[model samples]
Structures are given as structure tokens and as C-alpha cells.
Target chain A: MNDMHLCVVNITFLGKGPYTFSVGKGECVGLTGKSGIGKTQLFRAITDLIPAEGEILLDGRASASFSPTQWRSKVTMVPADSSWWYDRAGDHFPVKHKTSLLRESCMLLGLEPEVLDWQVSRLSTGERQRLALLRALQNNPTVLLLDEPSSGLDAYHTGLMEKYIGNYLRQNNPAVVWVSHDPEQLKRVASREFRMEQHRLYQIK
Target chain B: MDVIALTGVDLGLAASLLLLLSVLSVMLSLGLERKIIFFGCRMTAQLLLIGLVLRFLFASGSLLLVLLMSTIMLLAAGREVQARQKRKIIGLSGYLISVCAMFVSSFSVTVLALVVIIQVKPWYTPQYAIPLLGMLLGNTMTGIALALDRMTDQLHGRRGEVEQRLLLGQSWQEASSDIRRDCMRTGMMPIINSMAAAGLVSLPGMMTGQILGGTPPVEAVKYQILIMFLIAAGTGFGVVSAIWMSGLHLFDARHRLRLEILKSDKV
Candidate 1:
């Protein structure tokens, strides 16, 4: 673990008030909100994937100091509906890292190893969601942003993901901000929890 | 040798032949009678108007007048480009982009043709420059417009996919490489097809006109070839430039896709 910490300053985006928070290395923060409360927008703003005015710091370094590519690679997001551009699932993963625990990741999500060789269009939503997270984990991101990551998974797969993510955080020590609708799931995975009210996040647990 | 001139009565006699065709269309119930009559009237009016203005323009031969005509053509072409896009950016950005592309492409190609290729003594001679510029601008405008429109639509349509790549450490350039290539291909394809089909399926307009005006067949064919090559160059460059410049503008220094840069409307 690098003792890295993800710090966010007053991020005022999408008519949401200035948001301030910090997630330390090996720590996971759970974010819960109703539909369209600008939860995903917050993640986008933090990742600099969209336009916003604010400051985000990773390992005490301002996002401005990193190139867009470097910054995004450091702060990776696994969107609720994972996007697949290529024909086969394996094509989306970088060739150098394609086999890096690729089978293990599939197993962690209760998927077959052959899922990687399958066409993207043939994958179930749950498969796509798990693969999307595995892809992010493969990049060794400093900050992992998950937006309803387990929304498509059933209870069994979600539990598996929870176990995998917990072990991943303990091993890599990257800051994780997980957005989930299930209260029980939050209690299981998050070190701290926050609830959204009026387009802002408030610490609840 | 001078080509024979037609009297007004002679033209009317020729026009009557078109009327007979329209009458045949009506009898056949081809449903093209109104379109035939409308197109015939419009063509006559449009050609006569151009003939009158071109007579003045040719006689005056003022460089400033030629430039003014050129700017007007560019603006009209830009507006046409803006109007044709189904998913256009909102604001004057479309106009700015379309005109910028036209200026960057057609201007350079026209200058290259006049100075380097033709070496027309006065280079800016309206007699040579204006007609040549008109052809280049019109073709280049269509190509650029197609590319810009297609690229914009795709970027917006595939917003999720592109943003996802951006989130996964890809820069705007990498994220959009496929869409940009596809758009440029769409833009350049029409001209490439037209070039392939030019002489075999139908005689191109300029060649037909030259042959009708008593130029030798070989000379007309040669001129047509030159025009086709020039058009290909101008259109290819224009479409590429338009897509690249506009694509650059659509994103920020942070490599974030700036949808806000585009305005939507009927132009």
C-alpha cells in the first residue's frame, strides 16, 4: 500500500452544492441515493470525465497536475451500465494485462473463464457488470469509483463481488467510493456510509 | 470556329420538346409531370439569372468583386451545411466550423490550381478564378458538411461508449478514433463513387458543356479528368480538415467531451 489518500475539495457540479470528502487508502466509502440525485454526476466530476469546477487530489497531488489520461487512469469509474465497444470481451482489456488474474476475476464474480472469449453482445448484464469492474481493477487505479456496480448482479454474485472488493482493497489499499442502493450491502462493504439529500451527501454511518 | 447561337424562338422550340416529355409523363401516369415542369421552370430561371450576373462579373473582372462573390458562396454553403445536419451543435459554432472548413480547404485548393497548376497570369482573374472557385467550394462544402454532421451525430449518439473509454484512461483522440474515421469515410465516399462512375454511367456536366461548345472530344475528356482529380483533392482535404478541427473543438484540454460546445436548432 502506498498510503495514498483521495481528497476532494468543494466540488460544486450540476447545481449540487460544494461537496467535500476524503477516503483514505484501504478505506471504502458507501454512497446511497435515490434515482437522478446527481450521484453519477458527482463521480464524473471527480474523475474529470465531464466539465465541472472544483479540486480533486490524489496522494496529495492536485488533479490539475496530472494529464487527463493519467488523472483518469488513477481515478477509474465502473459505470452502472458498463459500455463495451469491441466485439469480444477480451478485446476491451489491454493485451499486456489481459491474462493478469483474468481467470481469477471471472471466478471471483462466479463467471466461467471462457466468458472472456465470448462475444460482448452475448454477455448477460450481470456478466458485463462484473467484467467492467474486473477491467478497472486490472488497471491498478489509485481511486476506484463504482456507480451502482452490483445493480445487475443477483445476491450470490453481489456477495462474491463484495468479497473480491474487500480483499482487493486490503491488498492494493486504493480508495473506493461505492454507490449502492442496498442498505445491507453498504453495511457489508463500506467503512463509512453517506446518504443523499437535496443533491448533497451527508454522512450517515 | 464560333459555335452557332440560338434565337429566343429557337430556344422556345427546344423548350417545347421538354413540354412534350412532361405531357408524355402525364399520359403515362408516371407521377413526375409536376416535378418535371417545376424543375424545368426553376432551371431556366436559375441559369438565366447566373448568365446575367456572370456577364457583368466577366466584363468587370475586379478582384474585389470576385472575392465578394466567393465569400457569399462560402456563407451560403455554410448555411446549407448547418441546415442539413440532423444532430447539430447549438449556436454559431456550426456556422463558424462550416465556413472555416470551406476557407481552409477550397481557398488553398483553388489557389494551388490557379497559381501552381494553371499558372493563370493574373492568378486572381475572375474569368478563371471565379468559375474554378465555385466548382471547388461547392464540392468541398458538400464533403465537409457530410463529415461534420456525421461525426457530430455519432459523438452525441455514442456518448456513453466514448465517455466510458475516457474514464478508462483513453484520451479524446483514442476514444473517438473509430467514429472520426467512420465519419470521414462517409464524407469522402460519395465523391469517390462519383469519380468511379463519371464517364461510364453518364457524361459529367462540365465535359458535356465543353463538347457542346465545340471543344474536341479528347480535349473535353482531358478537362473533365483534370476537374475530377482537382475535386477529389479539394473534397478529400476539406472533409478531413472539417472533421479534425471540429472534433478538436468538441473536447477541452482535459480531454472531456464538451457537449456544451454544440448548439441544436434548424440553423
Candidate 2:
């Protein structure tokens, strides 16, 4: 819950316009757009995951001021299609967050701690999605970029994730940009909402 | 002892074996007849051209001439490395990286062997330098090409894994460490295997050539060992350098995984 604010000014990517926006600490901004519309690109640009032209300031400091890794450490993204490199699901978690913190995260997501011991290939799509979010959250990021995070989840786990994320935002107070196609999910989770169309962002709520 | 020289007729007589292979290929409808004839002609022409060039190079013994020849060899080797890759990077950077990495590794290893190990007077002597450099460049080229191919293909296949690691606050180097290691191993594996099988499974070509040229068997064996060791070092260094350079080039300043830079063409 540090003094953090993500201000994105004149961000342009993939022929998208000079969109300007900001999310204050403890604020969640919902972004909705047509499937191919550039919601993911915007998140990528904000998180420095791809090349873009813009000034992204966190706590009044420009993104370029910090190293790419440094900036990314502060701003974490949970991609919709999560990728697992290691055989066991547990191997993906950073060693420092392995035992107690990881078990707590699993509990929050309604995941069994034993699931970590299972092979990644055997995990269901829903399990992979939940684990992906947990992997990012455990890092204690200052900014969260959630790209269709609930896509693969059923209603039960989706509700659990929503509650978990709400509590996480309250405790961590990070600036969050949540990209979701579901309007109802946005209404329940986001304080403000924006719609992307024609490569531009419009603040709808 | 003087080595026996083969006459043109003798070479043609030996070439008749290839003609027999081509005839057999045609009879069996194996579709290898054309390739056999084509490569047979190409190999003869290429070796003759090199023989002419080496004759002139040895007589002149100019450092400038030796370097020019070396550069040509290096460029050709670089092109081979690029062409061998299944997924090639877009633009000239890919070709430049291969050339630069090969130049650094092969030239340095060749020079070290000539100046330090062999102690050939006037280390740039074309007879010693060109052959040594040629061997190093040939082996290093294969190593670099294999490594580069593996790296680009792996990165393309595992883009998600790599970006996931990047998203987890890992540096690009940390993200790509696995791919890099895999590439290095790929590049170095061939040389390691050849070294392992050198005297046991087969007499190395260079050693057999030296023996044919009337070198004492023990002397030929010593030179073969030196050449093997030199090739291993050259290939190892070249692969590592190529992988390192590729790692830097593949990622942008913002640490974005620019997979677009790669153009995939199945070859």
C-alpha cells in the first residue's frame, strides 16, 4: 500500500492512438474491447512487455528511469494463456515464495497445495489460469495487468478469484488495469471502466 | 619419403565409381542420379579452384593476400550459417551476427594455434595459415549454424514461456537462460562426438590425408589430435559467442520479445 499511481500519457502501439489515462493507488480500471481490438497491446505497452511510444510514470517517476526488469518487477502481467516451462507446477514459483506464502496463495485461489506437486501438463486449463495469476500475485507487484484472467475459470473459481483480487487490491493498493470482455465482471470489480474501439480508448464509466 | 601424385587419368578412373553409383541410382529410380552428378561436378570444380588459389597464395605469401582469402572464407562460412537456419531473422543483422561471431572465434583460435602451438615462422604463412583457418572455419561454421537454428526455432516455439518468465520480473537473460544453454549444447555436441570417436570408431579424415601424404603415422596422429582439439575450441567459442550475440539482438531495449524480427521459412 505504498504511494503508487500509474499515469500513462500519449501511449501509442500497433497503430493505436495517443491514449492517455491514469489509475490511482488501490484503483482498478476495467478495459473492454472487441476481441482483436488492442486491449492486450495496451497492457503490453503499459507493462513494458513490448515496444511502444509513451511516458508511463509510477509514483511520478518515468518507466525509462528504471531498468526494464526493475519496471517490470513493479508492474506484473497475468496473460490469458499461461505458459509453463518446468514439468512440475511447483517449479515455476520463485524459491523464496515456495512454502507458506505459496500455500496461502493456493488457499486464496481454492487450489489444493498438493496441486503444486502435480505435473504441469496434467493441469486443467482452469488450473493453469489460476496458477498463472497466483504466480504473478505472489511477487507482490506494485501494478497489476490482468488480461482476461478469468477466461478459463468456471463460475466457482471465477468468484473465488474476484474475491481474492478484491482483497489483494485492498491490501496491496496497487494500480490495476484489468482487461475483460465480460461487462458484469467489470461492474463487480472495477471502479472505473473504459471501452476500446478503433484503436482508441473511451472512458465509459 | 616423397608422396605419390595422382595423374588426371587416375582421378577420372576414380570418378568412374561415382558414374557407377549414378547409373545404379537411375536404374533403381532413386532420384539421386542428378544430385550425384551435380555434386560430383561441383566438388571437382571447387577443389580445382581451391588448388589453383592455394598455389598462387603459397607462392606470394603476402599477409594481405592471406587475410583477403581468410575474409572470403569467413563470409562464405557466415552465409552457410545463415542459410542453414530453419527460422532466419529478418534483415542484415542476422547475417552480420553470424559473420562477426565466426570471425572472432575462428580467427582467434586459428591465430592462437599458429602463433603459440605450431610456432610456424611468420605465422601468416599461407600454407600453414590458410589450411588451419579453413579447418577451424569449417567446423565453427557448422557449430554456429546449428546453434543459431536451434535458438531461433526454440524461441519461436516457446515464446509464451519466455514472455511469461519476463512478465514474472525476470530479466531477459534470466528468461532466456534455458534456451541459450540448449543452443550452446547443440552447437558443441557434434565436435564433442567427433572427438570421442576420432581414433576409435574412425580414423579422422585429416589424419588419413596426412598419412596418405607420407607423414609418419605418429606425426600424423599428433597433428590430427591438435586439429581436433583446435576445432573443438573454435566451435565451442563460436557457438557461445553466436548465442550471446543472438540473445542480445533478439530482445529490444524495452525487453520486449520481438518475434516479428524472425521470418520463418521451412528449409
Cα lDDT of model 1 by residue, B1-267, tens digit: 567888999989988998999899989999898898899999999889988988998898888888888888889888998888877766787688888888888888888988998899788888788888888888887888789888988898899999988988999999999999999999999889999899899798889988989999999898789878888988888888888888888888999998877666643
Instruction: List lDDT for all candidates, in order.
Output: 0.86, 0.90
- Tens-digit lDDT track for model 2 on B220-250? 9999999998999989999999999988899
CA deviation > 4 Å runs, candidate 1: A1-4, A95-100, B1-46
The residue pairs in collision within model 1 are: B89-B263, B90-B262, B90-B263, B90-B264
Residue A10 in candidate 2 has what lDDT?
85
lDDT of 1 at B197: 94
Give the per-residue lDDT of model 2 (tens digit) for A7-74: 88888988886888888899999998889888887888888888778788998999999988888889
Off by over 4 Å in 2: A1-4, A95-98, B23-31
RMSD of 1: 3.2
**Cα RMSD to native, each candidate?**
3.2, 2.2
Q: Is the docking of candidate 2 incorrect, acceptable, medium or high quality?
A: medium
Query: TM per model?
Result: 0.91, 0.95
